[model samples]
Target: MPRLKKTVFFAALITFATLLSIFCKMENRSNAELVKTDFDQQLASFQDAIEKKLLKAVLQRNEKEIKQSFLQTRAKYKRLEYYIEYFFPSTSALLNGAPIDEIELGENLIEQPTGFQVMEGIIYEQPTKENRAELLNEVKKMQLNLQRMSRFNEQYQITDAQLFDAMRLEIFRITSLGITGFDTPDALQSIPETASALRGIADVIAIYEPASTDKTVSSAIAYLDKQPNFNNFDRLTFITDYLDPISKYISSLRLARKIPTVASGSALHDDAISMFQTNAFNVDKFVGNSTQFINNDKVALGKALFNDAVLSNGANRSCTSCHHQSLAFTDGLSKATGISKGEPLLRNTPTLTYAGLQRGFFYDLKAGTLEDQALDVVHQKQEMNGSLTQAAAKINSSKTYFSLFQKAYEDKSGKADAWKIQHALASYIRSLAPFNSRFDRYMRGDKKQLNADEKKGFNLFMGKAKCGSCHFAPLFNGTQAPLFSKSEAEVLGVPSTTDTIKPKIDQDLGRYALYAYPQYKYSFKTSTLRNIKKTAPYMHNGVYKNLTQVMDFYNRGGGIGLGIPVENQTLSADRLNLSKLEIEQIIAFLGTLDDLP
Candidate 1:
């Protein structure tokens, strides 16, 4: 009788535990549903506001009304940016992408950008009938795009993991793109938009942790609201004291909620505490999956091969001949010297510092991988003029190389092979990305590393100077942040020489040689400005002798402002109107980017 009573009691206890588990799961599901429903409603409201206010203002030629309506629409769009950008990026591009021509590389198709940026360019200009017609067309497109986005929200289900992931990325976007005035070049309304973006994230946070108030996010929003001026905004303080802390808080909240991070194969790792942290990026994501596992053995082998003259045709020159480690892996020459005496290479030798972080390798962005780049250089007549397969045979004959290969591959019969050589060399390049520059240290809480001038320079670079728009923070490279999937090429209309008058464009066709696309003309891959202090004679053609000349060129608005006839100049032609002192300050900031040895 006692046993029977015990069995009944135990069974009842088990049943109660299971019911509690189900209830907890159901509650979590309900939270996700609630968040999604709120987002959907917000998106619908944003679309309606645009259709009624912005579209009407454009039609009536009311400039004042148009600007006001656009600003309101921008705030609403920012609220939905996190989900829309993550879930429906293609649609998001149509609604609010950069006002540039996006070319589908393989398909050879051009996608003309149409969105808020396009509308801003038109509205900020004279309110002519032709401009109104163009603005009207973009407004109608946005209306349809928003409608299509609404349909996706209705059908698509959201998960707790995705919601958290999207929010974190949005935080990154605000720091990298939003505050930098990347999307609001003409409008300059990024500060308020950033506040709206934070509010959206705050709303979702409230749903998950209702009892806990996010003081960090609230503080940031308050600061932004109080000082909304673009030029006077303290971006450095905002990033360090507020945005970074808010991101960390969100990460902590997600952890406390026991939400799993979605496995997104982005350059920015999911486990990164802050975007400015050393381990924030995953260099492996930039390479092929097969070669991602880089060990010390591979790096050692690569280092040796990089210095050995045996890899060259006549066993005379190696990579170090052009790429000097003391000079940030760059030769202090206007152009790289060829293997044959007096025969120079077509382009300048770019620094190999942090080279592996990019999707594209060369100036023209013709090579997809570092391994491919290594192979190309080895086979090029002007460079190495040595076959990797042949080089492998040479290495195989050497007993020293045989042992190194055996240990690297963990195979008894391991021999030097072409693919292994390429991987090893690429591995060495990847290991070069040591995120330990003075600027990096400053960003990671070492406040004393940067002085007042450097700080102001950083603000200018990120804000008024428009340098951060291309040279993104953390990496300071062309790889767009929050995604870091693609490398951008810009047509700067680089002159052949430093001639202020009659500035003739460099004859090099750049990417146009590879694709023949009109848009690709004069387009060179945006190189990393991390070690800009050491890598002198800037530009693909090595046109500028010093950073001062480069600054002057940009200040005057690139080649076009110098009277160069460039129809497809990607750089803004309008003068930066920077004072000499401001230019000096920017240079001082660039000096801080040199990596620590």
Candidate 2:
């Protein structure tokens, strides 16, 4: 109880705490080192398999053996995918990303994709000498990428938080990409590969917590090991029953161990346990700046600003001129009408519902943030023809607007700036994402929210219909899942009209207008299918008036299948062969995505 004795006791306690912190760090490093060793071994095995089995099989013209060896090599690659993707993402892309020409907006360079997706397409095709040589070259390039990953891994320090985060993301990858055949489009080996991916996560988990029981993981892996046909994989059941539970389990384990959640900004909330949950995504993470955050005051201010024609210069048009919240924030028109009477805007008025979730805005994917999007629309001649600078001045003149601005921000200058105005409007738009649609309810365990036909339609959309492959679920948009880092654009070869016999490709340059990339010609950012029932007149150009007509276009294989010339169509030209009944069912499922008023 004496002062000296108390000081000595406290000093001992502090020393013990410091030692404990050091021990935890050491343990984390040990686990990470073990994971890295496993990853390096897997990479080496993949390279060896490619060199010893796959290339030789191709050289010998043994089709069966080549496929088998390729599968084995991919299994190895899948095992280390978590770290490779999390730590060295660029290298990971070169090794197994989508086979497309991705444009780096910042660098203004188109990166030619070369990875597993590319190799899968080539290897699955006829083993011609040209194809064989191309595959070999791609394989060699991937090997070099693997070597580069090895170099990076040696210097990389994997934190416990990052390890758990990466593991959870892999589950999302399996559900959204692996099982959907986004990468293995040609081979349809997604089912088996999914099992491999789950096993890989389970293995990593075991290294950290050997006593951990992965019941959901085991169940999911077992289900996938059955290797059902890709077309009839019962993805709805797999996702709701198996994959979702696995993600929760991993998150629970992470929390139980008191490991930190991911600290960096992501489309997903740092502490979200399930991607399907309502609070999974954080719109704030998608903002252009910290100033563009949402609050009750900001939302209310934005709502008033959104409906005010004062921002439209002398055009007398407001955001509500094109977006009506009663109709899921979309104008009920084929194409948006401009300030000029009877003149249509270039693109359809996309719904503001869940607009905050995407990385890109507009049909052409021009703007990077909602704030940027607000600025663009205000300046566009046909849309608003207003300047944010002038609009800010007008807002400052209004006493009502002054009070709203005072409530929303700390600035008492009584002068509205362009960026602040943009941020307030963007914040209001950001608050629009309410993931409480019927489909969302059903996914979250209110089973009665969806009927039998609706359930079947969801399965078809995710599987046979191949809709999920493009419209990644939960958001049902092109925002890439798990990472939720970027939005995707697809060239669907949409026709100018509904006329099937004499179809003509829509002449809209789309994203090509922004970058002039050949692959971007006619490419548009994939719009969210949420609230499709309410937001009618679909597509960027609003080509389809109804969901049935939209289904028919996709059913017949988009514009290319409609006999329209489309060399760069990203959509498959193969007929979906969906029966009329199946189309109805799919439409029913889409109806479930509508949010309750």
Candidate 3:
């Protein structure tokens, strides 16, 4: 009887435990509801700073303050951008949300153009002759677009907040691509929609915030992220409705520029934005182009073809292989080295920094212009390792390339002949002009830009130090335009580092290669000191490490090699006797000569 009673008690205990478990789950669900409300409150506080300032600016209708508000709005856009990159992600759809920054968001709120500043981030264009006209036209259009951008802002009655919001929304749209190839049909389209979506964004205010009101839930706060969706449009559909138009527009525009988008715009070949435009030479960045010298399209083409590896005998080195762009078109090497296992390039890779600005080309002034220089590099066995015929054949093989010569010279039967290739390459080389350093800005009336010491240094360069006379202004080069003026070829008695004693064999006779003039012995074209800070280990041999060392070396009149100098063994025909402080100022000023942003 006792055992039967115990069994009944155990059954009762099991039922009790099951009831308790159900009660615990119900309490947990209440906690989850509380956590969600708290999360929403936290987001509201983030925009409170922006909301307070903007509301004040609008209510007061203070135009001065509104302008200030616009500037503040720019700051808020940055803060929200930081929040998205850090806290919330755009792809998250928690009951839908306003784009990170409302002010910067666009009226159109669509895809393409608004995100980036004009021409900042790019996928890299492949410049070619066939599509050259189209690319150039597009560039011109882009420049024109910049000129016309103010009209759109005025038409939309865009507030500063709207502009910033549009750009911010663009950031996420572009980020979605993330280093991949994609068309921006919608990128430009988004600009218009951004204006509308921006209105849908809610301006919420926190009514109350009290500590210990309720750890789980707050009835006092009311802010939720909610954004509008266009009719029958989910995210993908909305994006397409807005973005597809932009892509179609840009594609059609290419036709006027004679860009052969797959047999002159066959419907199948329409989307070339994502497809690679290899050998599209005309619109590409110059390896070295003649635009600065003279806008010769053929010269530009020749430069492009010559710089390519396909023109080489071993198919290894392009002309650019040695002479690189970042190195100011000088191969960072003292002597030029050929890529093949054959022979060392006999001469030093002379800096072509301002070659286009020169009256003559090459260390010896052997080549009169860019065309003369490119032709030598192509035919010479050690350089391009290609004859005119071989280079032409190599170009014809590229389906993209076959049309370049035809379009460039208007000769449908263009075999790789001498004229077209040389002209284009030379044209490309000459366009590289670098003048807008801090120094240039100072010259062009930004007086406060220079530090007191740098100003003193500028005076030294012009006066006591005597650098400006030879280095020259703007170009920091001696060669002048119009080629008729005689360019200076000074015998600066530049000591060859290979020699310790008074030199004989190691002496580099510069201009003597052409005229065989005795006075031109050891004369080399003066390089532009602009961006000299970057191109280091200075001189013909890459000898010195710093500007200070170079300055001291010159001050001492050709330091080690010509320890005991003969006549004309110094820099600047007049000997510079600068104080130590003066040299520091000179170095400080030289540092200012960077490519202007």
Leading candidate by lDDT: 1
Give a tens-digit lDDT track for model 2, residues 407-490. Answer: 888668656789877888888888888888888888889989988899889988987888989999878999988778899999
**lDDT (10s digit) by residue, model 3, range 1-597:** 699888999888988888878777655653223333333343344235335653354345444553454344333333233223212332121111211122212352333232222111121234345333432333343334333432332333212222222223332232122101111121222222332222211110011111223211111011001222211112222222322332333333334333333321111122332111222112222223433234455555655675677767767778788777677667666566765564566566765654655555666666766767877887777777766567767677777666666666667775556656666666566555545567655544465667878876765664455465456543555542111133344445554553444543335556655555444556677666777776665665455556887777556555323454444332433346778998998888888876655
lDDT of 1 at 362: 93
Give the whole-model CA lDDT for all candidates, comma-separated. Answer: 0.89, 0.85, 0.46
**Best candidate (score: TM-score):** 1
Tens-place lDDT per residue, model 1, 1-597, is: 699999999999999999999888767676788898788889879988998999988888888999999999989999889888888988988888989999887787899989999999888988888989999999999988888878877899889999899999999888889999999988899899999999999989988898995588899999999989887687888999999998999899989989999987457888776888977888778887854577899898899899988788888889899999999999988899898787878999999988988989899999999999999999999999998988898888888888888888786976988899999899899899888888889989999999999999999998888889888877788988888988888999899988787679999999999999888899999999998999998999898989999999988888898999899998889888889999999999999999887
List where candidate 2 sits over 4 angstroms from the true fold: 1-29
TM-score-wise, the better of 2 and 3 is 2
Q: Give the range where candidate 3 is weakest over 10 consecutive residues by summed lDDT.
A: 216-225
RMSD of 3: 25.4
What order do candidates take by TM-score, descending?
1, 2, 3
Alpha carbon lDDT at 285, candidate 1: 82
Q: Deviation in angstroms for 50 in model 3? A: 78
